[model samples]
Target: IPTIKLNNGREMPVEGYGCWKINYDRVWSLGSWLFNDDNRAGQVVLQAIRAGYRYIDSAYFYNVEKGVGHALRYAFRTGIVKREDMFIATKIWNNFHRRDRVVEGIRRSLRDMGLDYVDLAIIHWPMGFEDGDDVFPMYWNLSNVPREWSRNGFVETWQGMTDALDMGLAKSIGVSNFNIKQLKVLMDSSKIKPVVNQVECNPYYNQNKMLEFCQQNNIVMTAYSPLRQGYDLLDDPNLRRIARRHNKTAAQVALRWNIQRGVAVIPKSERRRRMNENINVFDFELRDDEMKAIDLLRQMPKLLTFGTTRSHPDYPFHDSY
Candidate 1:
């Protein structure tokens, strides 16, 4: 697989395996610990590594970092993947939004993942919750918002992330769910530019303008939620036709469309065949007409609407990207 070199000199795989709900049958809320065991998710992480996936995208908010860490070590012990060969990425959650706690959040993620460094660490979102014992403080109470509810707070958090990079905690630092304006603010105030801006992108909503902006700035725009609950992306008539032309599944066509345009995508699954299918996109290329057809798919953008924290002042989607 070819690698895209970030401004910071980090090489990220163009296609990665998303680990949002890897082991579990379905995604549960932050309150899921009361009813289920998350420890089982780690085995699936090991499974992906054994299946030849070199990049794994996860987040502390998913409650699966510890499991992911276990998988990494197991993969190493079994000689499935080396520590240096895999690109591991995780995010800092909104609960630890304070500048003082931003580095601390990455620290927690490293400890949970059982790694000294992450290939890339990102600020999960622009919003910071009221500092408290609750992980999802905003979800628990809508009034729980940070005192600095503007770009200033985001800048402060970005500084802390910069410090993490300097201290060797992460090789690269970036943001998730940030709009064009927020990205500009950070790039202006910080010494290091964000390498990528990950968002909910797929054939349904290709984010043409945002992709152009990131490309112009030399930042990679990563797509998540490429296929959601209904697998509707797998059933789209256009995607189906494209898949038939390539002898690939609709899912592979959707993923390849993003990859062909230089947008990295992380599609998640636990099944071995499904896992390998997500990364088998380098075999074919999408023509200009097919790319245009996929780009013009009716825009029902943003499948992952974080409704619980929608009221926060730093909410990213208020202005369209």
Candidate 2:
């Protein structure tokens, strides 16, 4: 229930639900099935909304836009919540980097979500390569870099995004997966500074320097993968011990740690009980020593550093993430 004030004069929730790995088998039965059942996906979103979650994070790359859109519509129709009460966020995929195509992509997402406008829109990734003849190319394949990269296309795409804000298509705009150098370039060239930078963050991979840079620049940082893709932070002895001392769940402890550091977090879950548990963090507070103990737990490597991707000739993180 905590909120952060954006540089654009809007308040965003400090914690929210993320739908990155949500099951999409029912909607699109494509290759490498992770999980199925769109009904369950819709229910999870509805439950999150009912549990006082005002912010929902999603992306075109996730391929579950229909389910999220359906859930939002159903929730409104059922009187669970009003449209204005929710902050719906979606991202532009890497493939749509050109100026005209970026606008077309947002229109397609608006059509898919059945919404007039999104509360915020983010460029999904810094790389802007086209997909090959294959539907989904290998992570390392970079055969088709967009021509715009040669001509500073990101600046043009950013201008289109700014136009989206002026045209009332998106209330705010930002970037994702950008390193310090790329972020600085955008900041220098952009007429409207990016209000948020979504990136991978957690106790294990705390981005102190990046967080400080964004803080100094008035860009809110939204921490994705806060639990490291459910890599057992909830069961850590240190976290459990701190949770017991504060009478809170280890998950809440992790979330509170990020919120206290002034970084927004989006922890995803399908279980209704866990969804409720994740949102119930406003009641209790973690002590200063406990917060420091959690901060000290930042020994793990970055989970989604862009350098790992094969597209970049210079992967930026050779020195640090």
For residues 5-60, what per-residue lDDT tens digits would candidate 1 score against the true structure? 88777799887778886755435445444444555788788777877778889998
Per-model TM values vs. the true structure: 0.94, 0.90
Stretches of model 2 off by over 4 angstroms after superposition: 24-38, 131-153, 305-308, 313-319
**Sequence-dependent TM-score of model 1:** 0.94
Task: Give the Å shift of residue 16 in candidate 1.
Answer: 1.1
Tens digits of per-residue lDDT for model 2, 196-275: 99988888888888899999999999999887877877778999999888788888888888898999999998887888
Question: What is the model-wide C-alpha lDDT for candidate 1?
Answer: 0.82
Give me the candidate number with maximum lDDT: 1
